[model samples]
Target chain A: MPRKAADEIVIALAGQPNCGKSTLFNAVAGFKVDVGNFAGTSVAFAETRVTFHGRKIRLIDLPGTYSISSHDLAEKVARDFLLSGEVDALINVVDASMLSRSLEFSVQLTEMRVPMVMCLNMMDEAQRKGMEIDTSRLEELLGIPVRTAVAVVGTGIDEVFRQAIRVAGGVVPAVEPRYDNDIEQALSRLLAVYPQALKDALPLSERFVALRLLEKDEDFERKVGASSPDFLARASEERHRLAEREGRAETLALGSHRHGLVLDLYEKVVRHRRGNVLGTREKVDRFIIHPIGGAITVVGSLLITFFLAFFLGNAIAGLVDVPFGALRASIQAMPKGMGPAVLIGLFEGVVAGAGIVLPYLVPLLVLLAIFEDTGLLPRIAFMVDGILHRVGLHGSSVVPLILGFGCNVPSIMATRTLENPRDRFVTMMVAPFVTCSARSVVIIALAGKYLGVLATVALYLFGGLMSMAVSYSLTRSKKRKSLGVIMEVPPLRQPYPRIVVRKVWLRLREFVLVAWPVLIVSSLALSLLSYAGADATINGLLSPLTTSVLQLPAAVGIPLFLGLFRKELTLIMLGAALGTDAIGNVLSNGQILVLVVFTMLYVPCVATLAAQWREGGFKTAAASALLNLGVSIAVAGAVARFVGAA
Target chain B: MEGETAAIHALHSDGATRKRIQSLGLFEGRRICVVARAPFSGPLLVEDVATGARVMIARDLAENIEMESRAPEGR
Candidate 1:
């Protein structure tokens, strides 16, 4: 489609993975994107409007990609947008610390010939590595405006945007990258054979198309082949000629050729003086990544996060309980009828929301954010790959699985990084069973409240085991295993308190805005239903399973039904349904355990199901619901039997 | 293979995996070091000696990538 805002200048921030593009984007766009140390954190582009230098600027943070070669969906998203020609100006953010690899990507960006400026981000990182870069030299070398920025500290951020604004307003002087003489001849030869029809059809510049074609980019090759198979044939011949000269695949030959130029440029511009770097961090990793120690650290850190959130949430819950109880007593004193019931419904909704938000959701999100920002998630992924592989998952699958604990929506979304459709399907299928924070609230409030901490932990372990079993069963029939994980382990960084707070707020706000309102409205509706004596019919209808199989109180039917709306509602609505927020008053310990287990593994919340539908269509979503229903029934039934036997 | 430097000789993996690895700057003839390995046949942390960038390659993929032993380039 055409550009929506004709008058506004559209600038896009693009860079390789974890090179601080989101950091720089947020610096100017004011926290429109999530910034994390993990690669592929921003799986989708984030866009915002800003009035910069007295001009209406639409700035977009594209997903960070290693190259425009488009190996996976993230890279394809970035490449397609950049080549869409909608970006009026581009900010190529490069990590000053990883200058050589970053510059290799910068070299590819220059090939696009868009109006661009280079932002040398993380200059402090480079300084720590003892690499002093000559910005002027880089500017002269790349023939574009270059600026230095430490985005975390807000240093040189505005100057980077100022340069981008200037460059967008003016002409981008064409700066073509020159390769070695032979490869240059080969590229021109391939370009000469490029069809005029294809040239206009393809959005990329002719030289870039030629280079990517030479590199055997699948997307470009298909595009070119569709336009002119004869051109593809001729291009293959030219590739063979170059391969003959280089004695390797033409793709690698071109890649190595570009790397040679980038290394040359890097040497000319970067002066490396000795500095103490990586000593302490490496020593630390030696233990953190040790065969035995790494496993312990992973399990230990996760347990610590769990117990901390659990006890901390319980403590906060205790503090909030007295006020809510006092409010309830006053409401009870007012009257006993429909109006009082509705008032109590609304009040209890707020109380239940506060109960979950303060006690469970907030603490959990904060801890998850800390794990994410500290760059520890990938390490956990690395450690868990072997175990996950036994269940037919790649190591990088751990990222999404861990994120599933926060919410299933982003967890399903994060599966985009996995290139294989089967891998993504398997991950998504198990994601809902991963005990999201909302479900954790149900488990902790019900099981932890009465059944004790051991029961809560056991419930979590059972959920995890069920998810693994599901993944294994799904992948066992497939003949091919998932392609092995190849992920960049970003350098560990100190989690910035500011960023962590924003990240937690971003997640917590979802609970407050989306889930809390749902909680309130559902509580009110359930109260109205109970006040109208309609819940008896709904509860009677579901009694076959809830009453007979799971052996829970029939009043739990509405809560379990509405729990499909939001898992936390199972806990929140339980108070409204049972006529008391103190669930233990109604439920025996085994009954609560059965209820939490059924709630934990049953059909995911509506938002999660919607996300599943979006990611994998209706069939996958149906599979998830069916899978959860079947598993929850089977397992909870066994638990009910076992608890009764015990 | 921990803490040993080697030159990448051949990438015997299939198209997509090879492309993914190469996109991160791993290529034939470039020297890389095995920085760390996870237990029970997990991924290995490999670093490019030239760029100082680290990536975790699954043991399966690492197996397909033939690495010739090389003397460590003095740090």
Candidate 2:
């Protein structure tokens, strides 16, 4: 939130997707940068400060974009930031092995006339594949200082920044890219007649303006429109006539022309051993994404991750449970009638806040972040793209739903990885149907106790089917067909430990700050209601829904109600009301199945509702609650009737 | 063309899809390869041979990305 000082030099790190831009930012700026991979990870630039060459520079980690085309959100961010004129210089990070492709972007930066430097990152990987890039030759051709780096291991970073500081100080002049003679002649003509933009378009000029118009970039046209309505028209006419003269579209001719120049430059400097370049990545991807192998790996990896979070989260949660249990007992025993309701409320709040949720939520979020950081998740998304398309969601929805098995909160948060709003909403709503561990405690307890094993298995399978149906129905629209799923598959790397820990700590802090307050306060209120002897009144209120509709006895209402605050509480209170853990003492087998089904499908916990309210707004939260209520009640009532008849 | 290296002949995609692909360094004259396709009618994995940037195109969109094979029948 702190503003950069006026004198600090602002340097933007721009690159194609997964080009180690962020990896380099962390190496230089010291690991505080907010990290995300693939496209549009950071919608706007994430700024960090580092002292380089005796000057503290404000480094902006721009989103990964292939070019400054205004098609996607991330590209728009990169494009607008480059033209913003706030940047003192640019450091274009090019993946070293992918030199010719990355150079196409480098050529644009040079043409924009921004003082620039090129960071040829991933030099080690380039070498492993037998690519020998002549950095000196590249520097000679591009007119910008070039530095080589293996950013993940932090090599050549200091030299990159040292040269960046020197460039920002105006030691380097902006370089212009060469184009085809026909387009070149048209560019010169356009530049001659160009009406300058009215605003202070520093770092952009008549030449860059003319080229942008030639590229037929619509966003640039709109910006330039206020001053020159006829300017683009004249430029378009030139481009059109030129295209007619050449036997191709003007843009393609110019693109290939610019690309030809880049290819020629790199051709002089780089040597490659072809056919041998498809190395470990291709090998690993072959087995892992192979339909049979992919299915096993995906299923196997997810099962292991869940078992780890579940067992580990539960074990760590024990440390919280004991102290909070003692604290609650002491608070409950406080002097008679001294606002016992308040005291009970206070005690319940502490237990739910510390003892119940955090145990599972912390480990789950950390593990999910690890999957995200390692770039393993998008591959899972890629494999599942076909199945998920049937549900009106993208492949990325798989990551959040898998995380939803641990807890719905972070899984909902994980949907931010999904770019579309409707996708996020539908994913968020269906995510709760994954049978989170909390609800698992209640379902396993009740269903396992009364109906034995098979019905419980059937119950879980039911939840999965409902999740797909719900998400599909909520998000399907023919008009808003997804723009196709184009995910960047980052090379598998060791997860950065610092970033992983920091993400866990940051998101856990949200649970502590936002969700726990709602949780604790509601826990207190629920406990206070029982203490105030309002149990009978509550049972009466729920009678229509419970006995008449769900066909469960009135005694089940309080546990079902308290389950909203903490799902495990349903079992605890049920044991207390029934006078034993043997739930079959009061309920028939059929009645038990209906009750557990309703519990599993009913509204998400109060804390989860609070999260929905925060992330999706009041309308979304209300809609989800209504959806859960209607589905569970109707299903439970029909099943209860079928069971009674049987 | 299934396993061969090819040059993008011409893109038949609409505006949004075309511009989006262009941002991923896909355009006319770029060389590409069809790496593999999932069995039972899955997405086709295509890579820009020059960049090593891979994209998985659904069967429907593959029709729009017309290509002329560049590599010979056998390696």
Candidate 3:
């Protein structure tokens, strides 16, 4: 099996987690790549073309991994790419300050004999810490070019391209790391038994596989077995013999041996400063983390965020309502015809869902981006670490919980950051129960029409308490051990206006695109059902649950059911069902409070249900929806009973 | 105790250990100052002389760390 000639250069950008690899990729690529599903899998990959020396270069930003060992999905993706032999060169991004750990991966790549160059990123931070590395010596030891970079500040970018082009052009030879004599002898013995074809196809040197086999890496065994099962078994026996002679696991010995060499090389080349310096970040942290000061700041920030979201949403809703009102009035003027009613109803649903709700979500997402960009979210996470621990989650879960207030889909998606499976699952399950902006519209409209603004706020508080109680009870019953929050709190910088706006617009655009179609279809369906006298039949069935148990009119259940498709449609449906004036006369203040509470705790919108299934699987999704329905019914029933008695 | 500060000792136990220290700017021949310590056994505020940046680290994490104070030698 002969290999295909490299028609296009495939370069892999590899690094350890949180080492500024993504930042560097974003800086270099800058929206030039098509971001979508990677080939056949749902996993996303960004593909872009850059004209380097007049030749198009294809760059693949591989998932960041700690090592090539297949312990996780990220590691498997990275290791498979490296072993594929399809890539022409590798751009190994290393954090200068965290060189030693970065170097361990670099050593593994060097053993693969891949045409590679090292990008020592974060030079600014490294220099600030008063550390200097002798790049020349490092290059000599690793047998590859080493380029220093401060990626965020856009330094050494040209050098990165220059080295990449050189490697791609075959102007530079792959560098091989010098291993210990014992390992070298064993590798040569192992290679002697390998078939010529197998030897040529593998990207890494025979020695690297021999070392991995000694370590008993399961993935390595499977890979070797694919080529020669007999050879792999023989190699395992040899590894056992070597481990007994060495009086240790051959893997641990190999790691120590590599560390020893990296240390020897670093000793001669690295220099550092003596004492620490006082910086501005420390001064700011004092005020932000102060028990009293932190509380004030947190409250103030949250209030401002909510106020901006509410005011902006109200303004946008006012602007959108003018056309909708006119369109409805025109349809009513036409001789009460079925066609006019159906067209007008569909228009109302789209207007309510997309025009009114999505615009409001934009400003809120923008405010969230400001908080995330300025690094205030992590500080807030720190402040709530104590409370979060009590609920079987770490402080990091706060981000997703906060995001739930904006939209539950992304909030559930954000749960991927949590390491523990149980924590992620529980957070995703409960996030939709946190009344989002869509629910706010229903609460406000009902409160304004029947109750008042004060009652609306009180109902919101009640909803929040219910969400917390459910979260606590579920977590406690599960008996999940609280994991400590180990997060990197990035330095606070002024938010980038362009990036913030782009992120906000992107999210808002998704809301409009997905929500508008569903809303319009739901509105049309409801209108037809009403015209056909189906509402009466549905209300007759709903009377037991709404009128008897919840002590509300059967008419209210139609809108509540429609609310599951689009939340703002609940208000619109209620408006059409009860009319503006009749709603006030029909439902008393106590009944209105019951309605608002039930609506807040009821099943999430259809889009959110789809997101739930995607994030939490079918069982969790079905269970979450059923739980919401059960809780809404019980709470509404109890509240209605108490209010009727009072 | 004063004379012992000037004595040459094996400051770093091993290479892997030394690399971890170096990456965090707490390498051999580097100076570190404890700017502030939290009440009880909370987080510590420390400054790195090389970069002049102060960082807050948990006290428990700090306990596993070893540092050489270069302040004994007059700057």
Best by TM-score: 1
Best of the candidates, lDDT: 1
- Judge candidate 1 at residue B70 and give its lDDT: 52
How high is the lDDT of residue B27 in model 1? 78
Going through the candidates in order, the fraction of native interface contacts each one reproduces equals: 0.79, 0.35, 0.00
> TM-scores across all candidates?
0.95, 0.81, 0.76
Question: For residues A1-646, could you state the per-residue lDDT of candidate 3 as single tens digits?
Answer: 1343346577778876546665567667774432211011112345555666665677777766656765555667777777777777888888787675567778877776677889999787666656788998888888888999977667897788789878864533345666778766766777788655556555466777777786577788887888778778877877776677766554444655665566666676678764553357546766776656667777777667656656676677678777777776776677756896687667667666755566566666777778765667656655655555555554457767776776777677667656678887778767878878778666655674457546756776787678777778778877556443334444454566655664566566665776667677777877778777898888888889889988988887788878887787777677566643246787888888888888888888888889889877888888889889899999988999899999
Error of 1 at A149 (Å): 0.9
lDDT of 2 by residue, A1-646 (tens): 3565877998999988778898788777764665554344554467788878789788888877777766566677677777766778889999887787788888887877777899999898788667899888788788899999988778899999888888884654435666768778998887787654533443366777777777777777787776777877888888688767767766654665776787788788898777776667667777776778778867877666555555665576567767766765676567856387667656655565565556666666677678777777766766777787777766557667866765787677667656668777888888878888667656655675467556766776788888888877787654576534655566655677766886677667766776567655664555566666677798889899888998888878877887787665665566444433357878888988888888888898887788888889999889988998888888888999999989
Q: Please, what's the RMSD in Å of model 2? A: 4.8
For every model shown, the clashing-pair count is 0, 1, 8
> Model 3 chain A, poorest ten-residue lDDT window?
A34-43
Shift of residue A367 alpha carbon in model 1, Å? 1.0
Best candidate, DockQ: 1
Q: Put the candidates in TM-score order, highest first.
A: 1, 2, 3
The Cα error of candidate 3 at residue A479, in Å, is 5.0
TM-score of model 2 (CA atoms): 0.81
What TM-score against the true chain A does chain A of each candidate get? Answer: 0.96, 0.79, 0.80
Worst 10 residues of 2 chain A by lDDT: A195-204
